[model samples]
Each structure stands twice: as C-alpha cells, then as structure tokens.
Target: DVAMPDAPARPTTPELLPPNRMPKRGRGGSERGRIAMLHALAHVEYSAIDLAFDVAGRFGALFPRSFIDDWLSVGADEAMHFAILDRRLTAMGSGYGALPAHAGLWEAAGATAHDAAARLAVVPMVLEARGLDVTPETVARFEAAGDLPSARILQRIYTDEIRHVGFGAKWFGYLCANEAIPPAPRWQSLVRTHFRGKLKPPFNDSARARAGLTRDFYEPLAAE
Candidate 1:
C-alpha cells in the first residue's frame, strides 16, 4: 500500500508566490545570493517530497506494487535531499522559508491529478528532467566560488534525480504499451494538453537518455 494520504497540501510559510513575481536567482557571487539560491533549491526539494508521495498515493492503485515501491523510495530520497538542503542552509545561517518560493510546481501536480500518464509527463519527465539539464551548471558555479560543500550537495541531488526521471519514463512506457499508444507521440500530446510551457532545447540529451527519456521522446516537441 502507498504510504501517504492523497494530495496533501503544502506548507504556508516561505510565502508562496506566482512564478512571475519571484525574485531572480542571481549568480552565486555573494553570500546573500548564495543563501537565496540554496533556499530556493531547498524549497524545491521539500515540495518534491510531497510530489513523490502524492504521485504514489494518488496513482499507485492503478499500477503494480512495484509502482508504490519505486515512488516511495523516491519520496524518501526527496526527504533526505530536503533535510540536507535545510541543514546546509542552517550552516549558512539561513534556512528553508527564508526566501519566497513559487507555487507553480504543485499547481502542475494538481492539474494532472486525475491522469497518471499526464502526471508522469508533467512532473518527472518535464520538470525533474529539466533539473538534469540545469543542475550541472549550478554545481559548477558553486565549485568555482570555492563552495565545495554546497556543490557536493547539488551534485548528489543531480545524480538521484536521474533515477527519479527514469522511474517516470519507465512507468509511462508501461502504460503506453498497455494502452497500445506510442511513447514519443503520446508524450508530445500529453505535454500539449497538460503542460503550460514550451519544451525548450539544449536539453541534456545524454542525461535524459540515461533516464530513458531520449531525444525521440522530446526533441520533436521542442519549440521551433
């Protein structure tokens, strides 16, 4: 059985904002900027703990027992990641909720709540996969600034996110196969229907490929 309740609401602190109103995550040149960025990453990880559990609880009944196993593991990893980030923030004399976070992440979850396929497409495939593309540079920035501890934390999250994305792609493929739908085109259609933004490029194709989300799954859908 899944371990969490259905669609638990996020916390009230950190003063959630719409995506447009959130401040820019400035380059990690100053301690203030670095703390803000860590706070942002912490918020994402905290929200992800909910996302992993929500997906498992809300959709687990429709799939095999392994589905719950995989997602529950993902949730555990997200929780660990959040704890690490929050501790890192405290070590920096800051912590989670010290900065504002956007509510767009959970909004996407809510939009795809009823469809497992759509949920997989939007959250892990699109959003978590996007993390693969960007996190390397974030780690590098921290490293270049002589912030090895923070860089190491982000590097670990980057590695784990690859597997999280793999779980999404694997389950999505299973459902598509059972339904006699093709993977790539169906993914495109789902993104068009459920995702609010365009699929952009310069994607981390190698990392995506490692996660079973190849160019074939997303390249055609890239905004031209």
Candidate 2:
C-alpha cells in the first residue's frame, strides 16, 4: 500500500474560486456559454481522476482486491472523460484553463478521507450519483444548442458513471454486511455525517436504481 496525497496537483490556470464566488453558468444557449459549461465539466472529470485513485490507494488495503480493481478502472474512466472534455474544449476555441472553476468538488473527498465506507457513501453514491441525476438535461441542453458532439460526450460519460456509482454501492454494501449493519440506513448515516451539501431532488430514479443506489439510500435525506 502507498500513501495518498492530501490533494491532487492541478494546473496553475483556471483560477479556483469558492463555489459561491464562481460565476453563473447559464444554459448552453451560446458559444461562449457552452464553452463555460464544458470547461466546468472538464474540471470535474479532472478532479475525479484523483478522487478515484485516492480511494484505491488510501483504503484499498482494508477491502478485497476487487475493490482496488474497480477503483482503478474508475480512475481510468475519469481520465478518459477529462481527456475528451479537454479536447472538446479545444475544438470549441476555449480550453479548460480559460475560465475559473470551483474547488468545492474535492471537499467531499476531504470530508470522508478517514473512512472507506464514508468515502464511498459521499463521493460516488452522493456526488457522482448527482451526475446521474442532472446529466440527461445537460445533454438535452447541448442537443438543443445543436452541439451533437459535446452532447454525445456527455451521454457517454453518463453511461460510464452508472457503473462507477455501482462500484461504490456494491462495496459499501460489502462493508456494511461485514460490520453487521443494514446497508441502506448505514449509507444514509454515513452520508449525513460526511456530506456537506443537501441532497437535492428531481433525482433520476431509474439511473440511480441501475447503480444499485435506490431511493431507500438517499430519498430519506432529500431536500424538501
């Protein structure tokens, strides 16, 4: 087992801002707006690569080999997602570093760094599951703007993210069972303890169910 870094290295550009300080990203209604949206998405994917690897490196020893295998595969997927998004940004005449991004994405990782179960609960189950919730409409927005290539990229990422969340849910259940705890309430408890943000609704129930993250695990915590 290797040591995990407290944070991932990032490029000097794309000055990071607090989420509240970040500029509003309107719908992809114009070229500039679309670039902003894509850039932000690229940043998320970039950060996710490190998040996946950190989980493997930091907590892999506590779980089975399959755990390391799954998270490493997730890291690879995140890397690919970032690469394609960065390429798309370049094709659009704007690159990832051209705009500012929020640093809040990594905060979830920091909050749950101590426990693998908590990490799994908050990162993939809550954070990445959120991607499942919102990505369809984001794709539709790109399609509405006549940006088929970008829309297709998001669609592909959305599909891969289902499996990623599944990995998290699967292993979290494994951990819960080992400790003689019920999976759903254990997940909810971990999330409530480690997650900083509210569980917003309009959730994609079908996609979440496909990931083994059913309403039982999250619906109780949904924001009213």
Candidate 3:
C-alpha cells in the first residue's frame, strides 16, 4: 500500500463562516426595498437559530443546558416570522427573492464567527438587541394602521426577542467577567467598535430597557 500523508486541518476564520452556512449578498437588491429588508431579516433570524442550536449542542457545559431550549424556541419563532413576511409579500404579489438584500446581518455573524464572545457581541447583543429597540415602532405602526394581525404578531416577537437579547447581555457579561475584560466599559467599547450603524434616536426606551439594557448602555447611546 502506498503511504499517504495526513491532510492539513482547515482553519475556521470569522471572515468566512463554515462553508455550509456562508451568507451570500444580493438576495433582495431592488426597488422593493422594504420587502427585501424583510426577507433579509427573516433569513438572518433563521440563521441565528442555527447558531443557537450549535452552541447549545456542542458546548452544553459552557452554556446552561436550557440555552438550547431557548434557541429552539427562537428557531420556531423565526420560522413563523419568515412565514408571516412571506405571506405578506405574496399578498402583494411579490416574494422573498423579489428584491435585493445585502448580507449585512450575516456578514457581521461571519466577522465574529471565530470567537464565541465576538459572536455574542455582534449577533445577539448588537443585532438582535437592535430589533428589540426598533420593534415597538413597527408594532405601534401596525396598531395605528389597524393592522391588528401584524400588531399581535409583532407583540409576541417583540416580547420573546427581549428575552433573547437578555440572553446576549447575560452571556456577554459572563464572558467578560471570566476573561477579566472589566465587564461594563469593555462591553460598551466592543459594541461600539464592532457596531457601525448609529442607533437611530427617538428610540424605544421602554422595550430596550426591559430587555436587560443597563443605564450605562443606554445613557451614552441616548447622548449620541
């Protein structure tokens, strides 16, 4: 038999996610920007569900066992979210691919893929947390417009998402404490450095405050 040398192992970098989960941009780039944004958001939420499951399964000891349960719930919720958006789009005679969506959310996920702390920072804490802040306006708009069904659904999503961002805050704090990163300031700095978008003002303080945001986190943000 011919001798064969061992194959070199592949490196997993944040710049590129695992091959199967790589995010492709341009799924929703077009005139129907709102629908495209909806499509993109649903897909990213779906992807977060996958990340949650992996963490729950592979690192059970590191994370509370229930983390898996939480992620699974989020997964189910994401499916519903996708379905809702899909149905609405279809009602308008358009669908998920009808427009173009840049892969901003998943690109950030990829950026922090190599480190769990980074992942937690970029995904749940920054991205999903933003959802909590922004969702109330969406919900209120639905209510004002007499879109009761949308309002109801948005209410549920907003509530559950608060807990999800709370998970990020909890985990982020825990990781910082363990790593001796001086939890508070470090968290503020990391979120600021990695997150580029200015958090739009007239923000949903009540919803965000409910979602485990500390005064430290919001005060500076309010100042901005």
Candidate 4:
C-alpha cells in the first residue's frame, strides 16, 4: 500500500549530470579510460537495481505473481552487476562514486510511471535492448586492451540482459493480449511517447530476435 517515490534515492557523490553535460568516457584502451567506463557501468547497474524493484513495487499488483518474481530476479542480477563492477573499479584504483553519471537514466522510469506496459516498452525493450547492441563492441574493446576480466564481466552481463529483455517482451505481449491489442504497434506507440532517445542503428538483430524483441516493434519507429 505504500506509494512509489517520484525518484529513487541516490548516493551523494558522482554528481549526477544531464546526458549532454556528462563527461566523455573515452575508449576502454587505457587504464584511465577503462576505469571511467567501469565506473559508468557501475552507476548504470546501481540505478538498474532500483528500476527493477520500482517496477515490481509500482506495478506488481496489476499483474500476476510472476511479474514480481521476474522483476525481483532482475533486481538481484543488477545488484550483483553493481558489486562486481565496484570490485573491478577498486582493483583498478577507482570506485563507483569517483565520476559523474547520467542523470537521465531514471527519466524513462518517471516518464512511463503511469503505465506498466509503457514502462516495459521503454525501460527493458528499448533501453536494455540497446545494451545488447553495443556491448559486444565494448567487450571486444576491453579484450583488445588486455582487460580480460572486464571483458568477461561485460560478456556475462550481456547474456543476462538478453533474458531481462525477454521478460519485458513477454509481459508486454501478455498485457497486449489481455487488451486485445497488437503488441508491436502498441510497443512502437509507447516508445514514441515515453522514450526521449532515438532507436539508433547497427542493432544486434540476432540477439534481439533471441529476446523476442523483433524489428517489427522498433524498426518502424527508427525510420520515423
């Protein structure tokens, strides 16, 4: 019966900045660059922990128990991701709060807060799916830089994210089915309305297909 907060509680440091104002995290080729990359990722994982739980807390009552189960699992995965990244940062002589993070990470959550389907459409289906598209390149860069441990970590996270996106697609389809609406168009509409960013190209088609987030849902939007 408790109400969801407008935004999640944040740590005092790593001063949050607008996406445009955030400092560039350079290519993961040098120690400084890698540390910056890891810290940014750690911040993402930390914010994701709250995003997953907020979905459960704010919208769980509208769905079956399985909804809560799925999101709680995602939250746990995010927690583990944050912990490992923080450890990696410490090993590299940096930590999570040493750099500013993108403040707009939670903007999607706030934008879609009123509708569970929109939340799914924007948060996991759009945002986390973007991770799948970009992470392989990131892992390769880490490996090329001789940062095998960080590469492996990114690889593991990439695999888990496929499942998380699958969950979003699953539940979004379920909700659409319940409403007798087509999932793809509905998802497209929600993304257009709730997501502020563009659906960039060079997408990972195979990985997205594996997660059931086909191009039909996003391609039309991307073209628009």
Candidate 5:
C-alpha cells in the first residue's frame, strides 16, 4: 500500500475556465475559440492525472491499488487526446485560450471527487462514453474537411476512449457488486436518474460492446 502527504484534503473548485461556449447549433468555429476549449479540456485531464496519482499515493492502503494506476494512465491518454485536438485546432488558425468550454466535465469530476465510485460512474461511463460515440463522427468530419491527419487523430481518440470508459464499467460493476447490487440494473438506474441530455441516435455499437457493455446493458440504454 502507498500513501501521500500532500493529497488534497477535499475537492477543489476549478478557477480558470471561461464559460459555456459550446455551440448550440452547427456553426463554424474560429481557431481561437477551439483552442480555448482545448486548453480547458487539458486542464481537466491534467487534474484527473493528478487526482489518480494522489489517490494511489495516499490511499492505496484503503482500497484496490491498481485503479490508481489505471486512472493515471487514463489521465495520460486524455492528455494525448487534448494535445492532438488542440494541435489540430491550432493548425486550423486557432489556438487554445480563445473560446469558452463548459465546466460540465469538470463539474462531474468535482461531484465525484470525494468518491471513487461516483467518479468512475460519471467521468468515464457517462462522459467518455459520449466521446466513444462521437469519435467516428468526428473522424468523418475531419475527412470531409480534407483533414486526414485530424481524422487519424480522432481514430486514435476513439480507440483510447473505449478503453477509458471500460475502466469505468469494470470498476463500477465491481463497486455495485460490493454493495450487492447487480451491475446492469444499477447502471440503468443511475443513467435514468442523473443524465438529462438527449442521447443521440447512431450509437457506436461495436465500440460500446468492446467497452464491456453487453446487449443487455446497451439495448435498453439505447432505447431510452
């Protein structure tokens, strides 16, 4: 087991994000706004890495140790995601620190900050799962834009994001089992209660299944 002297005593409120700047409709974006959102996402992933590291360092004695490593790896992969997206956005004549990005992801991070179980549920299962579904569409957009390089980047993001969300599935199942709740039902219940956004059509079936979800888990979810 391991521990850290400097792990945060509690969750910290993020200070640097600008505001909710995601486009409401399909609209053209400037380089600056894209860059700003990338920077904001980077800040989040970087903080996730730190949180994972700290959890491993300070609380290894209390729970499973491997999750910490996984979370750290998740952070690294998200950092790569941020870097690639940011670079592509920059190459398009934009840079980070220009537009605003909602703190929704980070807010989820904070909401689950105090509980590893909640973190696993909200961050990867809910958020990164959305990324999984979007990756292919993003690639298509890139290819349509004549940006093969960006499409390739999105392909990599899709692959990595699947694994990241799988981590959530694995650990969330474990937690539910620990509390004597069946995994599938528990997950369905959570999604119904917490999520408010409209889940789009054209789900990534192969990717979702690869991320440890079965037809039983997804069919009902997709129907909702």
Candidate 6:
C-alpha cells in the first residue's frame, strides 16, 4: 500500500502558496470572513490526513504494531475532520479548495521521513501540540461571535488533537527508553536537527502536560 513518493494528491482550488505568501485569516466577523476561517481549518485537516498516513506507511516498519495502530487511528480522525469542515464550507456556499492554504504542512513529513523519532517529534509533539495551545481561543472567538456550530467542530478537533500529541510523546518516549537515550535531550536534538522553525511560547502547559509533553520536554527549546 506504499506509494513510492508518498505524496497525496494536491487539491485543485484555492491555490497553494508558500506560508509567507498566504494572506492572514481575517477575523471571522463577516460571513465571508467566517468561510475563510473554516476553509483554512479544512485545509489543515486535509493535509493532516496525508501526514498521518505518511508517518504510518512510510515509517511503520521501523516500529511495532502499537505505532501503526495509533497513527492509523489518527489518520482516520483527520479524514473525518476534513469531511466535517468541508461539509460546513459547502453549506456556506464555499468549499475546501475555495481559498488558498499554507503549502508548508507536508514539508514536516518530508523533512523527517528518514527518522521515526524525528517524525513523531515534529509532527505530533511540535505541530499538533500547537493546536492544543491555540484551538481553545479560536473556539471561543467563534462562540463569542454566536457561531456555536463552528465552535463545536473546533472543540471536537481540539479534544482529538490532545490524544494525537499524546501518541507522539508516548512513542517517542518508548523509543528513547528502549534505546536508553534521555528522552528530553534526544527530543531536543531531534528538533534541532530536523525542525526548521523556532518553538514560540505562551504554551498550553496544562493540555500539553495531559498529553505527556510536559514543560521539561519543550521549555528549554523555546527561544528567548
């Protein structure tokens, strides 16, 4: 079931662009503005589906059955999330590809393809963990604006993301323990070697702790 290049089919619309080239998501105060926000979320979940599968299919053999089980479940959840957002967009007369999305999401998978540990660290620990930090506020913004439906969807995604990050931390810790490498330093080393962006702060320390990605794992890596 492995595709050679392992790249998913690119969506046709909204035009993919480099992160810097993409415009900011406008405040969701207007109908158009709200559509844009949902579209952006749809794009991320769509890309996430591919990322989850890529991690499993591309590197599953390196680990055991539990690894495959976790990632496959993550991939399935991402697919469903994408469907939910896309359906919401359709109800609003816009769809997933109606606006451009960040093109850099898949780069993390490509960057860490050769290292299972790096893939877990960057994708789940760093990338998905970010969702835990920001999604609650995003959910509140929708709720404050009287868009409880959108807020509910985000709430569901946020809840699922906690477990996704947990899977990354769990597997990464297992790998470290199996090899007798110190988990924190090895994680830091992997991030330094593999991740391109800086770890910005105002972290969701509580949710991250629940995911088993405690402050000790990422705090030292945050920039001053």
Query: lDDT tens digits, residues 1-224, model 3?
Result: 33221221222311323434644533233325444445555555555655565444444456665666766666676677767766766765676654444356656755555566666766776778778777777666556655566457667777778887777777777778788886657766766767666655665667666766666675675477
Quick one: ranking by TM-score, best first? 4, 2, 1, 6, 5, 3
Model 5 gets an lDDT of: 0.62
State the lDDT of candidate 1 residue by residue for 1-224, as single tens digits: 54544456666679988899999889897778888999988888888989998888888888999999999999999999999999999999998887899877888998998899999999999999999999998898899998999999999999999999999999999999999999999999999999999888779999999999999888888954
lDDT of 4 at 24: 84
**What lDDT score is found at residue 62 in candidate 6?**
73
Question: Against the hidden reference, what TM-scores do the models get?
Answer: 0.95, 0.97, 0.71, 0.98, 0.75, 0.95
- Please list the residue runs of candidate 1 whose C-alpha ends up more than 4 Å from where it truly belongs after superposition: 1-7
Candidate 6 structure, TM-score to reference = 0.95
lDDT rank order = 4, 2, 1, 6, 5, 3
> Candidates 1 and 4: which is better by TM-score?
4
Off by over 4 Å in 6: 1-6
All models: lDDT? 0.91, 0.92, 0.61, 0.92, 0.62, 0.88
Tens digits of per-residue lDDT for model 6, 1-224 = 64547467884776988989888777887778888899988988988988988888887887898888999999999999999999888988988878888867788888887888998999999988988988888888889888888889999999999999999999999999999999999999998988899899889999999999999889999952
Q: lDDT of model 3 at residue 204?
A: 60
Q: Which candidate comes out best when scored by TM-score?
A: 4
In model 3, the runs with Cα more than 4 Å from the true position are 1-41, 54-61, 221-224
Q: What C-alpha lDDT, on a 0 to 100 scale, does residue 205 get in candidate 4?
A: 94
lDDT of 5 by residue, 11-91 (tens): 343344434545432411433433443455445555555555554444344458677777778767866776776677678
Q: Is candidate 3 or 5 superior in TM-score? A: 5
**Which whole-number lDDT from 0 to 100 does residue 201 have in model 2?**
89
Please say which candidate is ahead in lDDT: 1 or 3: 1
lDDT of 4 by residue, 1-224 (tens): 79999998887988988888988878988889999999988988999999999999999999999999999999999999999999999998889899988866698898889999999999999989999999999999999999999999999999999999999999999999999999999998888888887998989999999999998988888887
Q: Could you tell which candidate, 2 or 6, scores higher by TM-score? A: 2
Worst 10 residues of 1 by lDDT: 1-10
